[model samples]
Target: MPIQNPLKKGSRDPYVTIAQQQLIALGYGLPRFGADGELGDETLFAYGTFLVSQGLRAPTDERPKSITPAGTAALDKAFAALAQGGSTANIIDERHNHPHSGRSVSMPYRPWPKITAVVLHQTATKIGEKPASWHGVPIHFGITRAGKIIQLYDLTEVCNHANGLNRPSVGIEIDGWYAGIEGRPETLWQPKNLSTPRQPMNFPTAQAEAAMTIVQWIVNAVAANGGRVTHIHPHRQSSKDRQSDPGSLIWQTVGLWAQNTLGLSDGGAAFTVGNGRTIPEAWDARYTGNRY
Candidate 1:
């Protein structure tokens, strides 16, 4: 079925179906819904994310929006990018296990004795820039704004992501800074802090979906390797005295989604709106001191 009406929420249009098919093929597919073609939250989020990955502005509203001609052009670009062997998921080649040269964490993470938790982090710097000069690429994986997942390190070892919990946690960094970082006038991972009313962060629909894929991948990896993740923690949740990297609202959304939908463990919430379990600042310590 061709797009009969502008693709909006709750429509059963076949064009919505076609768009969903294309999005999934480009690696922006919905995990749970799987191109059922209903134009639901997962499908729209993926569609919006794909548009954003092309650097096109996509509205954050849940109401359905019509796809423009330029949207088609971007999809063409995405397919071309994929044709060249581009992928959103990867793992470091096992042979280069000795911490290959680009950057290092405060201290090398010991191989995970057992992965009991998944700790999420943000680069806290612009995408494509090295975050290591400060925090050290400390994450096991890094997801880019365009939705590609790069394996920074072979996650068998722990990196200094969480100050004290490295041994039992696996850290994954999604590219981009959190909202409210005073230095960044823009390019925040989200436009609104999911947990608080701070400066807008503007997380792309694509990046959010990319993050969920990475987290689920980690969970599956742990389960396969004779370990099972018991909790999912964000950088802010584990950062007792450290910089709050992954921020609040995004992580909360991810953690809850994983638990309620995917059956992953929800150790507990890191922070809540006005609850104040969070460190008072969003700046990474590597960039500033006592951000609080």
Candidate 2:
């Protein structure tokens, strides 16, 4: 004999209403008709049996709570908002609705992953200055000279690079030439407030600041989605064995900001290398997949 649990009063939806009667008829204890919010324990038991009869196991308890009518309406509204590129986080002031780019770039793909880390790279070229395109060019999210962040590829997708592709990461390209440390003498450029390292050329403070803001945006976005800021990494750190883009200075700067400002532990990495390859130790959190 199943224990009776009655539905609350005045409920009426065809499926629920029918389900209620079915439970009552099936020798399950339940509320009498005309007083109800939804089917109770006995009804749910009967529903489970109904489903099992159809060759399916009962829906697991681990599933998200069943959608109520009100919840369903709210979800529809949320999807609408997301489609408009609305800002979903409450703490962040910035609301990006598709950043503007002067160069001809691809559309923003929306398969936004957990956004573990922000990998920064100097574009190594000016805006609209095309790089030689063979097949399998790496894609990037670009922040132009004017400080606009635009999507270079859809989310969770990969572009060609010297290293891994499509494993798990997003790349961002800032417009600038990456004059390696060896090229500093000819470029005659240096970073302000610090003795420039062995290589230096055209350290754009404005661009750096903008890049920080974007990183903050990404961090906030991840946090809002139940992730943490500790996962952020620059491109150089990811492929330390053979690559460098956002050079050491920018990496130190952004990483320190993440630690000091965001208060993240800086543990866990996001990049991994194998097949006789190696990713830098700093990027361990981003690639291996860390949970917030």
Cα lDDT computed for each candidate against the true fold: 0.56, 0.42
Query: What would the C-alpha RMSD of candidate 2 be, to one decimal place?
Result: 21.7
- Choose the strongest candidate by lDDT: 1
Point out where model 2 deviates above 4 Å.
1-114, 128-137, 156-162, 179-200, 226-229, 240-242, 264-272, 275-292
Q: How many backbone clashes does candidate 2 have?
A: 19
Give the CA lDDT, 0 to 100, for residue 110 in model 1.
45
Q: Write the per-residue lDDT of candidate 2 for residues 156-231, one digit (tens) a residue.
A: 4444432432234455666665543322343323355756443444444445445556666666655665655455
TM-scores for every candidate against the unseen true structure: 0.51, 0.42
User: Number of clashes in every candidate structure?
Assistant: 16, 19
lDDT of 1 at 136: 39
For the record, the alpha-carbon RMSD of candidate 1 to the native fold, in angstroms, is 12.4
What TM-score quantifies how close candidate 2 is to the native fold? 0.42
Off by over 4 Å in 1: 1-113, 129-136, 180-200, 241-244, 269-292
How well is each residue in 72-152 modelled by candidate 1, as lDDT tens digits? 556645543432332234533332444544323554434443778877777665566333332335556766666666665
